[model samples]
Target: MLADRIPIADALHGKALELVHEHRAASVPLLERHLSIGPDMAEALLLRIARETTVVRRVQSGLYVYTHGPIGEELAALHGFAQEVLVALASNSVDVDQLRDAAGRYGFSIPHQAAGNATVAVPLCLAQVVNV
Candidate 1:
């Protein structure tokens, strides 16, 4: 059978996704019971699911939660920072320093790359923030 040809690890991951999305639960113990897997295997499969997809996140010790989106509607307000930064950029002909300050005021610290020791990096997070 083609389904039988699939490896157990991959099959476990698929079933786990189905269960999480269907039931809104990612309980390791539940998966262990359903799949006839022990705790260690269940833990490993859960870790694999997390690394391969964003559908599940460990919200507490030994507890996993299913997430429908990367960020929920409750965090809708946080996106304002990105929007505000974009507005400031669109409204200004500001220099690099001003841009950095504007982004900082919006609560973002742009990442910097160093070419030499003790050198401050460029505030290139400007591009990231705008895209955000």
Candidate 2:
């Protein structure tokens, strides 16, 4: 049932949520470190999660940024697996360090720069979400 029930979007979103919890914010380096993925892959995942959840925030230059609020909550819930993780992190309102620790438990290795950055760059996969 688990195999049959798992959706690609759900899995991807879960991964993104885990990275967000670990980084306390979404950034390329954090996502790459946590997921063991490249910056491109991490961006793709973020974009996918954002699109699937219908959570659109303004992009500064090329990076996507979101605050802890209703939109964030809704986006987290869209992925199911990410909902709890996001909620737990958001509730305490911890900083990037705390977020990195949380991600470490899940085997994420974030970068210092990524943790420090506020902007998260999204990948092309997000096009689907934007188009919809």
lDDT of 2: 0.51
The candidate that achieves the highest lDDT relative to the unseen native structure = 1
Question: How does candidate 1 fare on TM-score?
Answer: 0.47
Q: Name the weakest run of 10 consecutive residues (lDDT summed) in model 2.
A: 123-132
The CA lDDT of each predicted structure is: 0.59, 0.51
lDDT of 2 by residue, 13-50 (tens): 68777667555576767777776766676676666655
Q: Each model's TM-score?
A: 0.47, 0.40
Which regions of candidate 2 fall more than 4 Å away from where they truly are?
1-10, 54-58, 70-132
Question: How many pairs collide in each candidate, listed in order?
Answer: 0, 5
Residue 82 in candidate 2, Cα distance off native in Å: 29
Clashing residue pairs found in predicted model 1: none
The digit string of per-residue lDDT tens for model 1 on 16-106 reads: 7787777777777877888787777677766666657667666647577675564532233234544655677788743455555555554
Q: What's model 2's lDDT at 114?
A: 48
Top model by TM-score, which number? 1
